[model samples]
Target chain A: MLDQQKVFYGILGLAVLATLGWGMSTAGPAGLAFAGAASFTIGGALMCLWERSIVRSAFSLMATFCGVGVLFILLGADFVGMAQILIYVGGILALLLFGVMLSPPDMTERKLVRVGGGLLTMGLGVAWVAGKVAATVKWAALPIDQLPEPKSHAEEIGVAFIHPEQYVVPFELAAVLLTVALVAAVYIARRKMSDFVPEVASQQENA
Target chain B: MLSNITTTAATTAAAAAPSENVVFHLLAEYVPEGVPGWILPIVTASISVGIVIALISVMAMGFTWLERKVSGHIQCRYGPMYAGGWHGWAQPIADGVKLLMKEDLIPIGADKALFMMAPAIVLGAIFGAFVAMPLAPDFYFADVNLGIFFILGMSSLTTIGVVMAGWSSNSKWSLYGAMREAAQVVAYEIPLGISLLVPLIVAGTFNLREASELQGDFYGMGWFVFKNPFMLPASILFFIAALAETKRAPFDLPEAESELVAGFLTEYSGIRWSFFFMEEYAAMYLMCLVASVFFFGGFESPFTYMAREQFGPNAFITNVVAASTLIVKSIAGIVLMMWVRWTLPRVRIDQVMTIGYKYLTPLALICVLGAACWEAIF
Candidate 1:
């Protein structure tokens, strides 16, 4: 099973690399972006299917995040791309792995079971979305040639967040929201002093 | 008169343009025209990767030797003196050869795929961070606009590698080490990033090369560490946070030798173990380079006249001087780290968190705020 999985991933990785190389030679940045997107989506799906281990699944998620970051970089959103990696891989994934590791062993080891009817429904839903996207979008009419030269958006985004005429309010609101969430999370995770006191008293009475 | 003006403008523009001496441009000249568009970038990338790998390997070997000697002197003993005659100059090489010949081991019931992939991921994260590092004015792989941010982001990926290694090892010790590493990295990263922002705020740029160039005046006095009163504290904060980030003592709880028996490394053997070791030293050097770039005059010498005025006309000389200066400064930073490691006792895991969250984080935040105000006022 391990060897089979290796072959599957090996082929997938090679295909992605080949696509990336071809795209770079022929269609340039747009091709690379497309290839990155395809690799992330397809590779992530395959990893989810092949890996029974939850921890390995989390690693696949990190790869998907990295692919998204690559797409952002290709689109000239360098700051966003880095932020994607920092926030998703560094912050979220670490928390996720910690949670997984700390959880009950049995819960962590449960294999992903597939339901036949659910798979059919998921496939149909995906097909419908693809059809809708195809119908609504004019892919051939994209102005690939007219695309502007790639440039960094770091300064622009930074200034925009603080500029009164730009996204200042939204920026402050986001900060406030994050602070609130952080406080709430700490509140939930913290061990209450009152509960600890009661447990200590019970232990003392037993002694 | 118009021609004179045009000629002067042209000269200025030429000077402002990126130097033709950069590795990328040099590689570009070697490619035959009309061959293929992708071939140039591919070739350039391959060469850049080759150069970085070779440099990193040599540095790793040198650092391992230095570390042993440092550790030996601190303990009042000679370390590896016989490996290559005087001072064990060839000790790392011998160790590498031995490691290569050693039998590779996989523990029973270990996840083979992840076990194999972990080291590669760790090394890849470390190498990717090098992409944005400007070794000299004309000696970088890529000068991304968000260069510092890119490095920070890539460095964070190492946590995933650590987690993978620990879990895949199928050992209690490995799991403990991995968890500790994950927690420590996540904790330290906040202060590390916030402290880094002080320099970014002062420079008003995220590009490391630009930041370094910004400090290329005042004969090194203009470096960010001395730019403001707050900057000195900020640099110290960054260094301490960096120590934690690299898992150097007193923050080396993850692999605490007295406690976890090499921690996550308990299961690793041979070349696989060496990969982790190399990555550690490489990361230490990378953080040192980052420190020099952010706080000290990166490639710029204290004697600005020598770096900028005298040798400015010769691109090659200027690049070489700049590269040497940066390396020297980085080595100094590495030595400082070693000094701290040998001097201080290891902190417990809880104390590490307390230092990171309660002390370092708030101090860094205050420094950022102060630096911003300082910039605005003066």
Candidate 2:
């Protein structure tokens, strides 16, 4: 088991070095930083899959989200980058961790059918992403002059979200959906004093 | 014609924008002419990191001593008056040495690796958040476009560290503390961010330095609170959320000493415990600094105004005055927080959730709506 763990870690390290080499050749000095982030993203995903501890695996998912945020920043999407971290790592990841923390700890059971299904889904997902990357060339290379001259695109993004012709409907819909979800969560998570109070009262009388 | 006009306009606007970072310019000016240009960014980053870390360390020390004195006074006690004389001025230094000399222990049941890594992660997240905080108009670690967003996101990362520390300790108290932290963060984070929208809308920018500069009109007295009435309530909401976010008294269920016996710090001791406290103090100061920038006048005071008026806007003395003003304001804010901590009793866990979710969140939303409407009108 120890040797297997070592081999897995060794593969992750080699993948990092390979990405760094590729990044350096393509983007020079900045490419090194990009490669580092890319490797971190991949490593975090692998760690998430490989970790036995549920809590640690949930946190590895956060590491992956944060790595994606850095990649967004490097690609010059500052608003998207910060928002990704704010919404995902800060908000959703916290919920994910909370759910994992509150659940039963002895959920280490392995099933053959589930494993087969997971493997098939993972294989298909990887192939789809790989094919898309091959299909796209220079999607990131926007002309400098054509880009808007705003240091912070937050205000523009806010406007776009609420614009009549743009995302206003979907934005409002998402808000409503979240409110419904929150209400449903409150109902589910609320304390059931109806059952507990009577039991406590009976025990008190006996005492 | 439209494309041509945009090309020229974009080029000119980009040129007029301030040099990416002020530190880079200062480094370029002082360094030897023969040095490579690429090395300057590395040097500047190193210097900025050193400055921020030093500032955090010194601030933590000062706040520790101050907290002791403040709490003592509030409770009608002398409070450590002997160490280094003068109301125990050197008490923090003594404590630092004592903590350093203590044994570092990990409980047998604790996850050894995570037990060690937790404090580092907590401290490192705050350090990353400080990268966006500007002390003066020209001095900052990083001039992030979405400065407040970056700070908020980075600071929230501390919750992960705190949770990890709690879980890895394998103690019942630690788990309870982590659970409370999770609940509190979920309840209060929305109100915290929404309250800030009142000022963010008024300033029309997310960059702290730009927000500060925009308020420098009328001899540096034009705070956002003056421009919008909702900002007052928003600022109030922000402070409450800040208190809860930093786990101050009244919302400090996560580390409730009376109940949980130090909660998440049940297993942490020596310098590791000190790491958690350092992160707390640093985060408190960061929250206050954000408040001062968004609601109060950041780096804008009569002294700064006078210095700028006397020595011109570009003068070094103006920056000095500005930095001092910001420091004083943040210290005042921290003191206010400490005062509340001494004055108020800790609320029950249920009350905390109710106040945060039922009261603060709605009030924050109302403030946001009012501010938006006010801006739309007059």
Candidate 3:
């Protein structure tokens, strides 16, 4: 009389427990940290898939982003971690939630094709990132074995961004582009109210 | 030579070095070596959590008491004089007990999980932000190099909780409240962070301790506002944005009583209802504390300088004085917020957006530009 869902969860829990024990025996703290981050990411994705409500699913997506932020911190990129949370969770997700108007549309139909397509895309992405990047990329930032005795990652990043021979031009260009994009967004979003409420096309478009 | 973004190369170089926080050091120094090494961090973290929770609870209680008293005095009456002697000093405690004893309710139509989780998220986000707040130079939960930015991000995360609380409530008023909270926070966040940059440019480092220590010159008269001309205006802008950020008067549209019927808390009750209030008071204190550290000399006062001079620099007496000075400055800020809250009427949501986007954002940017120029030339 066991529910299928309960049985699945129980098995999954047992597998996780066994793996954690084995991993701890072999890899110590690194294994534990990896396991924790993986749990957060995978759990978020699972919840995102299992949830019926769109708003809840979006929150689960946020959880996934948060996990990624934690991973960035684990990799010694504190500035990037904070920035990711600030930009993604704080800025982007807030706007998305606002746009949704805190309302979830009732979702009754589940398309098999969409699910299958999404799974395939995700699997392919994981393979491409975890496989090629690990094997090919030369990490000049810091080698794992000779970790620099803790330095201000923020300072390092700030220097890299503004370094004359490095990223200064690209940084400034990105800033200018973002500013232009912001202005354009505002301009387009404005209702076509003209001077003295005269006409619809008498504003930016008319000009 | 490197561009002088932050001054004092020795200090800046040392900032790059990692050091265990005070609590960790204390536990390591005192605790027996027989305990497993891995459990030490867990113990340190739990202790920090315990301290922060206690501090927050006490501050929240005191704020509730002060709010009532301030409101009553503003209206020419005594508030809660009967609950405890001396103007109902125990009123907050009484309220706490009542809230704790009350039955929890969830609307039948409410998303049960979200309904339960919303308050936790709201409270949890604030707690995470508190990690970066340094109580004294030597005493803090964490010595995060990106302290202020980390706090700002965590506060932003609280918006999700507010929205969830509203949406999960299954009430129209809660929905309205949530939407308002998101919009206000989004609009004001730009000005809030930008205005803070006016002082950050002068201080160079985002470490709250470093910022405070730098201002210990001229008998602690060396506040950032004194060093930079644009800082005063920027501080004013920051204060305005902070008011909106914390949803205090003239900006408390999310939970405006006259219009939204308690806003996001329409369906919440008991302890769950109190968590939102706790977050509000804590956030207000945090914003004020940031202001004190950034613009007003955080932990730097004539009193603290004297204490440091009297006792050794790292003496407990100096720390005590410094802690009190910070608490007092933050209290002054809270009182100012309360005064404004009682004095000014709440603005329309449209007006809030207009003010945040149109006025504050531009002014903040101008201040930043002026500060930058002043820094480069001076």
Candidate 4:
């Protein structure tokens, strides 16, 4: 098993490097970085196929998120990239790891169970829709003539949210919705007052 | 037609000047003329990576020695007097050699893949953060407009590594340490980010170099630390939060030595362990450098007039001086951290949470508001 795992990782590493080389040749340095990050994401996702441990899967997911973050940076969406790292890696992944560590020990021993037929069909349907959308969008395939210069779109994004003629209402609505969700989450997570009262009454009766 | 002529003239002038930035000029000199455009950027990136690695290694060695010597002095004793020629200045080198030759041990039942990758992730995150840092006006790898934001984002990546190391170790203590690290980093990040926003609001930019440039006057008094009453408290909050973020003492519950036995690091050894240490010290320096840029006048000299005047003909000297100033300020920040580490007792995990959520967060929020108001009024 150990030797197999090593071989698996070796193949993954080689595949990633090969992709990176291709990216460099096609898109130059920016492309190279993007390719490297993309390879990590892909490799990590592939690892999930063989790894049964929930903790290992969580790590792989984190790697995928990090790769996505790098891809954002390469695309000049600096604000988005930073947000990806902050929210996904720092907040969500940590929370996931906490859940993994705190759960029952038997959880890690479970194998990756195959999905039921219905769920698999639903997944395929969703992918079909995604493919349709993907086909409709035109992706520019520029030649690798020059290195893509890094641009800062942070100010533009900040402005668009509050520009009045742009996405101000949608932005404000998103904030309100997030706030509501947060309150709802907290209310759900908190221990019930009734439960505490019952415990208090039981203690008094026993005394 | 008129615009075309002016554009051409501008291009000619730019070609004549050949960019005074050291990295730009150095790469230009090395890459032969008529090379592909992509080659320059690739070569420059490679050089930057090389420089970053060297910088991290050298600084980590120095910090390890400095940390030991400081602890020793604080405890009233001589530290490693015989490891090297004088006062064991080469103690870190000796330690490095020892660590290299020591047995590389992986605990039984450990998750080998994650265990092996954890240190690399931590080190990579720190290195990524360093790319956006500005040592001097012309000395950064990339001057992204959202440089400070990028650094903050990259620094948060370290938590993932810490968690991976802890979880993969399959040890209870390691798990506890990882959990503590996750909680601490997540909690402290709020205040750290809020404090950072105070300067961001005042400067109206997230670029570290630009922020530093704005305070490049009035000698040291022009620093954001002394910018306004709000900034003073903001700086204090930032410093405290930074201490927690870096997992330094008084907030070092993640690796509380007496309780957790090195925490997430319990299962690591040899070069793997050294990578963690290197990441920590490098991160410490990165945080200090960032704080200096935001709160202090980054690469700006205390002699404001001299700094401004030296830009004419002695530009290279100015760059060197600016870089040195930033380094000195960063070192001072590191020393302050060391002082606090040795001086204070480690806080309980609960206390750490209390400080982060109860005090620092609210105070930092208030400072942000106050800073915004101050900026508007001023």
Please give, for residues A35-106, the per-residue lDDT of candidate 4 as tens digits.
767776777677765565667877788767777776665565657867887788878888888878765443
* TM-score, chain A, candidate 4: 0.75
Residue by residue across B1-378, what tens digits does model 2's lDDT show? 111111111112222223356767877878987875546665666676667778898899999999999999989997889899899999999999999999998999887767888888788778778878888877766776678988898888888888889989999999899888988997899999999999999998888999998888888899999999899999999999999999999799999999999998999999999999999999999999999999999998778888989998878888889989999999999999999999999999999999998999999999999999999999
Give the RMSD in angstroms, all C-alphas superposed, for model 4.
7.1
Worst 10 residues of 4 chain B by lDDT: B1-10
What is residue B211's positional error in candidate 1, in angstroms? 0.8
TM-scores, all candidates, are 0.90, 0.89, 0.89, 0.88
TM-score of 1: 0.90
Least accurate 10 contiguous residues by lDDT in model 2 chain A: A142-151
Residue lDDT tens for model 1, A70-154 = 6565455656767987898888999899878644333243332544555677899999999999999998977653223456677
Per-residue alpha-carbon lDDT of candidate 4 for residues B1-378, written as tens digits (9 for 90 to 100): 111111111111112222234566677877777887756654555566567779888999999999998999999987778887899998999999999998999998897777988888788777777767777777766665677876787788888989989988989999899999999998899999999999888888988888988887785447887777798888889999999999999888878899999999998999999999998999899999998999888887665437658564246667677788889999999999999999999999889999999999999999999888888898
**What is the C-alpha lDDT profile of model 3 across B21-48, one tens digit per residue?**
6778888888776876656665666577
What's the ranking of the predictions by TM-score, best on top? 1, 3, 2, 4
lDDT of residue A44 for candidate 3 = 70
Best by TM-score: 1
For each of the candidates, what fraction of the native contacts does it recover? Answer: 0.55, 0.39, 0.55, 0.51
- Which docking band does candidate 2 fall into? acceptable
Q: Write the per-residue lDDT of candidate 1 for residues B1-378, one digit (tens) a residue.
A: 111111111111112222232565787777776786545554555566567778888998899999988888888988789887888899999999999999999998787878988888887777767766888776677666677877788788888888889888988888999999999998999999999988888888887778888887776557888887788898999999999888889888878889999888889999999999898899999999999999997887765437667777237777787888899999999989998999999999999989999999999999999998889999
Lowest lDDT 10-mer window, candidate 4 chain A?
A106-115
Look at candidate 4 and give me any clashing residue pairs. none
- Clashing residue pairs, candidate 3? none
Give the clash count for each candidate. 0, 0, 0, 0
